[model samples]
Target: MVHHRPRTRERCPLWARRARASTPLRTLLLGLLLTLAAGPISMGATDGGGIGGTGITGFGPIQGFGSIFVNAREYFLRADTRITVDGRAAGRRALHVGDMVVVRGTADPARTTGWADVVQVRHPLVGRVDAVSAGGAHLTVLGQGVRIPAGVPVVGGDGHTVALHAGDWVAVSALANARDEWIATRVALRYPAGSVPAGVPAVIEGRVASVGPNGVLRIGTQAVRLEGAAAHKSAPAPGARIRVVGRYRDGVILASRLAPARPALGGPGRYVEMEGYAVPRAAGGLHSNGILLRPPGGKEGAGPTGIRADRALVFTGRIGPDGSLEIERMEPPHAPELPHAGAGGGERGFGGHGTHGIERPELERPRIERPELEQPRIERPEIGRPRIERPEIVRPEIEIPQAQRPEIPEVEMPGH
Candidate 1:
């Protein structure tokens, strides 16, 4: 059973001004006192857990009191140590073994564990992936209630399902029993790309020109295909700029629905690299963005701060009209080196780069050429434990005379 909730936001008040007013002398004195006595501060949840609170905006586990959690929908501040700590801790903190936390915020129906302002982070799992099918080449994780397809959009580490090939290692969270199968709401691959940004699946606002009979919409010169039943109802007038959730499919984008036009951050000519799976190439050698990159193991509704690309490459151009990236260049990463062959033959003919003719000795020759050491000898039993008997020590009969011994000399100190 999945419970859907509304999103929340984070708010920061006049705490900045108060900190700025305090001078170095006062700050130093305060620091000294804090060092001597460690106790919780009583400020709002935006001042770094000081007398005020702290902002939990970035990654990593956050520690401290009075934390603030923010996202697109809303902001929230709670007294709970985990909530007050940071966003990353929401899972570990809110979802303890048996703790129950109530959440009130906007819910994303499409994804399980999607991002929310997180009014509350409590025990048990929240969210779900509606349908599961086998022909989609998807893998049904019997433990997490998730059916991750072969080429789903994912952000590595951020906790989203990335493209999966045979033998790929992945981490699964919130495994539940759904029928006879185990379902995982969160599925992540072991190898993930770097950080992804917030508000990705970012809104690309543009004009809507034509809606074909097939429900393919055109914005400017670009044409977009829509999925689900929402496509037909969301059609817009030709040349009408609109915004749509750029749900990517196979490297290319198919706009889900029409939305109001809005300004977008990170524009054309900005050199950026996004890692995702590569959908099969289209008729014109173009491929769809099939990457399911997120932070290594991200949940749904979470901002995409990372990605897992099927093929790693650099995107030098702007995002195209269809929401597909216009790739200026593609680069495949170099593979690791293999073990070498014998001396000359190994270095020269490795990777099929060089050819060694008949002059060089073949590698098939026996490793040991000399047969003299091959003959085995009879074994001899050891006396006791193979002890090495030392030769008898011979002592000289005469001892050294006292007169022959050198006399000792004493040196005096400066004071003496």
Candidate 2:
């Protein structure tokens, strides 16, 4: 009787054997990695693409000036770049460091710098200084209360801080707090108490309190008569923020222009950078002004995670269809750089135009570019890890002779 010898199973290779044991787990981990990588991109997060073609709009304080820096990025101003300050045409000489501005332009892929097509600076409060506190820390303008905290600069046309007194025709650059209170960034003396320049248009921004027939709009205690094209157009709805530009006569503003105070940055799918303070949200994520910012997944708050809620930050992201900003990255804003006096006699300081000693009002023009001054470096504090200590483990001693120990068989366990 001939019987075939039993064939033994061939041993698999070491690498193959190990891979076989964890194949399912590895596949699961790979799938998780892919999902995480695609989260932001799928949510319309910009990869910083479209260097010259993509439009970028941002709102932030002017950090410095080569052309101008906003939201930590330098924006190169053009010769015809339309600039407006409080609904009036302005030049680069009108821009100041630390002034909050809105820039609409196109940036490179890195988003570090770009070309500015339009720059707008809007002062929240522009009217006669109603009352100044005894300590000069608080004031009221146009019935709106304003608070001046320590270190908040009160700048004049000469770039020096001036004492604020009652009945001064001043313009206040400020940010409204959550309580709708104005916190002054800077108080500018536009004109002396009774020396306001004639032909300087009177501008006021406020919510529309009421509307009357024949193009009459009331804001607070002030009444505005919208004329010309502004009157012919549809009147702004009540509660809408409106900016009126015209002259004041008999306690009423004869408005030649009426526009929205805060214009929307861009439409859906537009990339935008915004700088604002973070406030915790009830649902999740954080709130900057009225803009909602969330991480890629929207599962958690994007801020207070390596970011302080009290501090301001520049958020880089895209505008969602619902007007929310899906935050892709965020960084602390660059500190405001104070302009230094140039060495020449006629040359102005670094912030404004340097006319080289000639004083001509007609010659005053917007600066397309300027030499970049050395800005003081800001060093970040280093974080160190704490050392951990583990308790020592001591084994009990059992004196046993090695030769008298019992023999045990070795067992090979299969990999899981």
TM-score between candidate 1 and the true structure: 0.21
lDDT of 2 by residue, 145-218 (tens): 77776655686676677998776777776655444456665678887777765545566766678999878878
- Model 2 spans with C-alpha error above 4 angstroms: 1-53, 109-111, 197-199, 212-214, 277-313, 322-324, 329-332, 336-416
Model 2 TM-score, 2 decimals: 0.58
Q: What's the CA RMSD of model 1 in angstroms? A: 30.1
- The models' CA-based lDDT, in order, is 0.33, 0.68
* Residue 277, model 2, lDDT: 61
Query: Model 1 over residues 1-416: C-alpha lDDT tens digits?
Result: 99888776555553333455558866786787776688665444321222222211111011111222211111234344334111235433232111112232222222111122333321111111223356423443211234332222233343333555433333332211212122222344443222222222312334466778777776534445766645756467775545455443332236554554421213332222332223232222222222122222333323222323233232223344333445544333211112232233211101111111111121354587765666678798776866698999999699777767688999888986
TM-scores for every predicted model: 0.21, 0.58
Worst 10 residues of 2 by lDDT: 347-356
